[model samples]
Target: GAGVSQSPSNKVTEKGKDVELRCDPISGHTALYWYRQSLGQGLEFLIYFQGNSAPDKSGLPSDRFSAERTGGSVSTLTIQRTQQEDSAVYLCASSLGVRNSPLHFGNGTRLTVT
Candidate 1:
């Protein structure tokens, strides 16, 4: 894909279930990011991956949330023991690098925890 791509555009899961969101960045983009937006809320940074460096997971709200990027191309976000508060649209974005470039965002994955 020429831009970021996210899968499972919509997901409905019971509370306590686990879910995984996938993202495929542009062919040569070296910077990738994951963010979450709750209803009526702003985007919250979740994690960031730049090249071969260790991903910055400080934005993750809990230990239950984790992410990883492989081959500097694909990334995945895993949420454990989902809660109602976890319901939100997960967005993935990519750029040539962290600076001097606009990010290309994917259609988010809308997650609903019942």
Candidate 2:
């Protein structure tokens, strides 16, 4: 794909259920990031990976939230024990290996835990 792709464009799960969102970055891109955007809020960075390694995973809200990038291009974000508050758009971004690049985003997976 020319752009990033994410699965389950919208999800509705019961409260306390777990959810997993996936992201496929542009081919050959070595950097990936996951973020969450609550309604009416800005994007909050969650985790980031460079190459096949993650040097930063500090932004995960809690142990319940985790992510991993495989082969440096695909990523998955798992939310355990989901809550209504966790109902937000989970976004994935990828960029060239540089600090000064614009992040290209997948149309995020909107998780709605009711």
Candidate 3:
């Protein structure tokens, strides 16, 4: 894809279900980031990956949220034991991993927990 791509544009799951969202970064990009936006709210950083360095997972709300990047290309975020509060649009972005690199974002996956 020419830009960051995310799968399953929308998802609906029951409370306590697990959900997995996938992202494919633009070719050759080394920085990937995950963010969540609640309805009419600002984006909240969830995680970040840059090259092979350790991912910055400090923004994850709890152990139930996890993410991994493979081969520095594709990434997946898994939400375990989903709650209603977890419902939000999950966005993925990629950049060149350089200072002041602009981020290209995916359309995001909207997850709704009932």
Q: Candidate 3 clashing pairs? A: none
| Candidate 2 similarity to native, TM-score | 0.93
The runs of at least 3 residues in candidate 3 whose Cα sits more than 4 Å from the true structure, single-residue gaps closed, are none
What lDDT does the true structure give each of the candidates?
0.93, 0.88, 0.97
lDDT comparison, 1 vs 3, better candidate: 3
What's each prediction's clash count?
Answer: 0, 0, 0
lDDT of 3 by residue, 6-97 (tens): 99999999999999999999999999999999988899999999999999999999999999999989999999999999999999999999
Measured by lDDT, the strongest candidate is 3
Error of 3 at 4 (Å): 0.6
Candidate 2's residue-wise lDDT over 1-105, tens digit each?
A: 599899989999999998889999988777888989997889999998898554598898899998877666678899999988898999998888677888899
TM-scores for candidates 1 onward, in order? 0.96, 0.93, 0.97
| Global CA lDDT computed for model 2 | 0.88
Candidate 1 has an lDDT of 0.93
Error of 1 at 31 (Å): 0.5
Model 1, 38-57: lDDT tens digits are 87889999999999999898
For candidate 3, the clash count comes to: 0
Residue 6 displacement (Å), model 2: 0.6
